[model samples]
Target: MRWAPPGFGGKRRSPEEIKREGWREQKVLVVSETDPRLTWPERELVRQLGDKLYGYRKEARHGRLDP
Candidate 1:
């Protein structure tokens, strides 16, 4: 799976479009540590990536690096 920053693809849809497509809004960021398809090394990589993204997101939101 690929991850991208929110709203990169296009503008917001109208209510009619949303209903027609059955779109649902939810939290955007997700880190899964238990994906069975990932090999041991890949899982480790994902964990590290998740850590980095989380830290960066925290810093961006709070204007300071995580301790």
Candidate 2:
């Protein structure tokens, strides 16, 4: 589909119609480590990635539960 040029074209129901110039989305992945569907390796990788990006969790840092 040809994207329309960026401008006011009245309110659109689906924003996907307009061409979003220079717009990049910052995305987050949400998952539960204990989710039954995920395997051990997948859960471990997710845990490692979280720690690498955000540092040690508050629970581990303070020796107490965060929530």
Scored by CA lDDT, what does every candidate get?
0.62, 0.63
Candidate 2 matches the true fold with a TM-score of 0.44
Best by TM-score: 2
> Would you give me the overall lDDT of model 1?
0.62
Provide the clash count, candidate 1.
0
For model 1, the stretches where C-alpha displacement exceeds 4 angstroms are: 1-31, 56-67
| The 10-residue segment with the lowest total lDDT in model 2 | 17-26
Cα deviation of 13 in candidate 1 (Å)? 19
Model 2: per-residue Cα lDDT over 1-67, one tens digit each: 6666776465665543222321434343566667788999999988777777777776656774433
TM-score of each: 0.35, 0.44
